[model samples]
Target: MDESYFFKLKSVAKDRLSPNGEVAFFLGILLYSGALLGICFFAIYYAVDFKKTSELFKGLFIGSGVMIILLIILFCLCVLFEKMVFKIQKIIGVVTVLYTIFIAYFPFFYFFIYLA
Candidate 1:
């Protein structure tokens, strides 16, 4: 009886970690970021009708905000996909390196543009 109890306990302990831990964390981050992005989108969307209401303003307000939010979401999705599978990771890895290079090179490009 004791052996069976121990075995049962061992089996129970073995699976303590939820199988979906990574997915859970990913979703949590997605939900939080989505809320944040939604708010920023709303703020910019409203800015259209709220234009005369605020002193500081930028045209294409919604466009810029949406683009930024999308980029952020894409980055997050890419990371999640990378974590979920190595095949996807290789693709995301390439994309990530390209993105990093593009971002890194932009300063030089800007400097050149400024110099020119």
Candidate 2:
């Protein structure tokens, strides 16, 4: 028999107009690093009160370390191309900053709640 027109392949063009989310990724990096630096500063400042705030600083350190690890993992994923960058990256960074801030002041929250 004869195969006149069976199947055909079409060439696909690259999408040049769409955003690559580099801005989001850079913003995430900025926010993550800034928060981490702030945590370090607070931990250092509270080191003088070793008796009362040691546990608080310890928790902050641990939380910051975990956050750093997670951000590193995200960086690696971005490098691997397995996941494309998006606004969620910036949201993650913002959430990390907020979460760390909340954790750092947890003891104060307890104190304020107890007072009020």
Question: Which candidate leads the pack in TM-score?
Answer: 2
Question: Model 2, 1-116: lDDT tens per residue?
Answer: 23433322111112331223443443465475656456554655565343455565556556656755666676566556624645455654565566556556644643432333
lDDT, model 1, position 14: 50
Which residue runs does candidate 1 get wrong by more than 4 Å?
1-71, 78-87
**lDDT (0 to 1) per candidate:** 0.47, 0.51
Clashes of each: 0, 0
Angstrom error of the Cα, residue 30, model 2: value is 5.4
Model 2 alpha-carbon drift over 4 Å, by segment: 1-19, 22-52, 82-116
Residue 16 displacement (Å), model 2: 13
Estimated TM-score for each candidate: 0.31, 0.39
Cα lDDT of model 1 by residue, 21-76, tens digit: 33344445445545554665455456534444333333333443454455566556
Q: How far does residue 90 in candidate 1 sit from its true spot (Å)?
A: 1.3
